[model samples]
Target: MTARDNRLHAFRPDLADARLEGEVSAERFVAGRPARVAAPVADVRRAPRPDAGLNTQLLCGDDVLVFDEAEGFAWLQAERDGYVGYVSAADLAPRAADPTHVVTAPRSFVYPGPDMKLPRVRALSLGSRVTVTGEAETRGTRYGLLPSGEAMVLQHLAPIGTVAEDFVSVAERLIDTPYLWGGSSAFGIDCSGLVQLSMHMAGRDVLRDSDMQAGALGTPLDPGPDHSALRRGDLVFWKGHVAIMTDAANMIHANGHTMTVAREGLREAIARIGYLYGGPTGFRRP
Candidate 1:
């Protein structure tokens, strides 16, 4: 698909957000006020929507520092595990975050209904690759971030491929994964996740994050027939994302707004996500 800028913002709050379930411990949270505590514990959860400090997700356990109380969010550092995001006050646990966690296979569960239970989160198929960044406890179950940037239960999975072929083969499985923010699974994925998983399936260790990925591949070529002759298995990369080219003018990838794996007009998808959509890092193949 030709690269194009999608104006819509795909930054949906994590399922751990208060919309689904009451903010439980371990659900990332922020505070509207900075209430001084005698001493913070590693497992201390914050009160719902603390009206004082901003607890942004940081690389630490439940330990959070009060940044801006007016921001209605607190900048928090995870003491148990360091990964950060904004959490609303209503759900902030004034105590230690919970350890109930779940992870996704390779591709699974694009969207979980508001009423969906947690244990059933694993009903989807196991993905070949997994990354546990975010966590949430719904009802009595734990859900973690799927590679697709969604939420799912932990699971076991098999390999996708052995080398570059694996990237091409396994990616073929997500021909329709929807585009999602922070998504990295087949159920819903973003541009970067598609590239990362494709490479992972091939048994080729590549950087998982998007910006870092720009430097992970070998020297890139221009997106044209003259540039080493584009192949079906060649890689098409942009500033913050990548895709697999199935033809000289066609490619497959997950877009945030599109929210699905799709074959886009090669130059167009590239132009949209690359030149127009905060990308243009270029393409590469191994």
Candidate 2:
């Protein structure tokens, strides 16, 4: 059967076209268990090993469809982007509790107790979700209790439904964050990850990759030679890269060339990217 005909095609498209001799069926391998990320940050790996290549990351409260569990890994598909990979079984919880708050700062510490002097439980990246089960005040500082019973500064989090006025501003907050391929957290992010995370904070559902984003987001912009028509929030697309126009003259993106999120003159960026990847393929405005 063709790739599209297989029931598990989306989970493992590579095996769809392989010839099988016996009466083997894809359903024999499907587990179909629902799961959610329990850790502050869980790395999704290409293989079921601790040292395997990282494919992506899942933050707390992110949902996944667990297809199998073996050794210390759980093979699953991320709910947000449908990415198939293996996450540590320790990070996958059967409970799918709804999140009440999202981390608003670039990063925030989860304290063992409500006091600032207490040991930190973990650090959560921006956009990480958590369930607040209670509230407390210590030494004049207010904190929220996570479902795991850890305390985090309430001011560092916003209700899950909160949205930023400008997504570009959200992207700018991560100026010095290191670039990681397929990373979506503040610790490290890719070009499309920055776009997706920023747009998500601004209440827009953006695709995970640049190519998918180029086809899914915004209105097509017709720019004359030299791209003199770009404006704030405009999305410029390259063959496999993307950036946000901060204004008429500047653009921001997480580029491996820079090794971090940075702003550059639109003309300078155009010239630099043109030399590297043949200029932008298109422009779009959301």
Candidate 3:
């Protein structure tokens, strides 16, 4: 076997890091088979608090790769994106998606049956991998893919590859989801809350609040006016507000006015605001 095969066949290391300070939430390991995050009120340490109740709040496909049930924290090295924080053992689930899952955009959904009329059961998130179980009638609107080798109809794109794409995919779902200060649930989310939630869903551990988030991302790219080269997922900082860059020219944020997640033109929004901290200190992948 080659190096890749050797790595996969090599003896497994301990993943004590993946364990958190709580009870097992879901099912446990079945030996030879991969492990699953225990379901219940398990504490996901060093993890971004998604909504509160805290039982493995946000789940991510990325978590599986670095998930070392035998270690303290699973370290996932991104091929493109950088590194993220750790996730407790209870938050992750089995990699049900087969390598064959497909999507239309970064984030998408799948139906239980080929018939659109059939009630859709499970909703697959971004970066989910699965097999093409069966083909559905080309409705020209909905798509289909197999999840974990199981047949299913899909409507939208099943995001695959790259941590950056996965983060962006999860971010889009919050669009128009509504904004709330200190809110972290699907019901409501604030600016930093948006970033924190999005990152958390993508398997990163980032804190809430603009200042804290600013410190967490990295150094500010610029120190003064000149917010021109802002990339997608970049943090747009202000006096009391912060937003996630949806694109180079647009951003999505939860503000007091909109009180929900909404899109804004980057330059237009920046120009409209009086104070602009164009200088981004740094960039944080997680």
Q: Considering summed lDDT, which 10 consecutive residues are worst modelled in model 1?
A: 1-10
Q: What is the lDDT of residue 153 in candidate 3?
A: 46
Better of 1 and 3 by TM-score: 3
Go through the candidates in order and give the clash count of each: 88, 0, 46
Better of 1 and 2 by lDDT: 2
Model 2 ranges with Cα > 4 A deviation:
1-9, 13-31
Predicted structure 1, TM vs. truth: 0.46
Q: What's each prediction's TM-score?
A: 0.46, 0.88, 0.48
lDDT by residue for model 1 over 1-286, one digit each (tens)?
Answer: 1111111111124313222244343234333232222111111223324442322211111233342333454333332222233444332444332322222244344335322442343333223223445666667655565433556543322222324445666677777766755554455566766776566546565544455455556556666554437877677666556777776767787766466877777767645664466645567665
Candidate 3 has its poorest 10 consecutive residues by lDDT at: 3-12
TM-score result, candidate 2? 0.88
Please estimate how well model 3 matches the true structure, expressed as its whole-model Cα lDDT: 0.49
Q: What value does the lDDT take at residue 205 in candidate 3?
A: 50
User: Candidate 3: how large is its RMSD?
Assistant: 10.2
- What lDDT does candidate 3 reach at residue 61? 36
lDDT for each residue of candidate 2 in 168-286, tens digit (9 for 90 to 100): 99999999999998788999999998998899889887667787778768889986676778889999999899999998778999998889999988788878889779978889998
Model 3, position 164: C-alpha lDDT score: 43
The CA lDDT of each predicted structure is 0.46, 0.82, 0.49
lDDT of 1 at 139: 74
Residue 133, model 1: Cα distance from true site in angstroms? 27
Candidate 1 C-alpha error for residue 233, in Å: 3.1
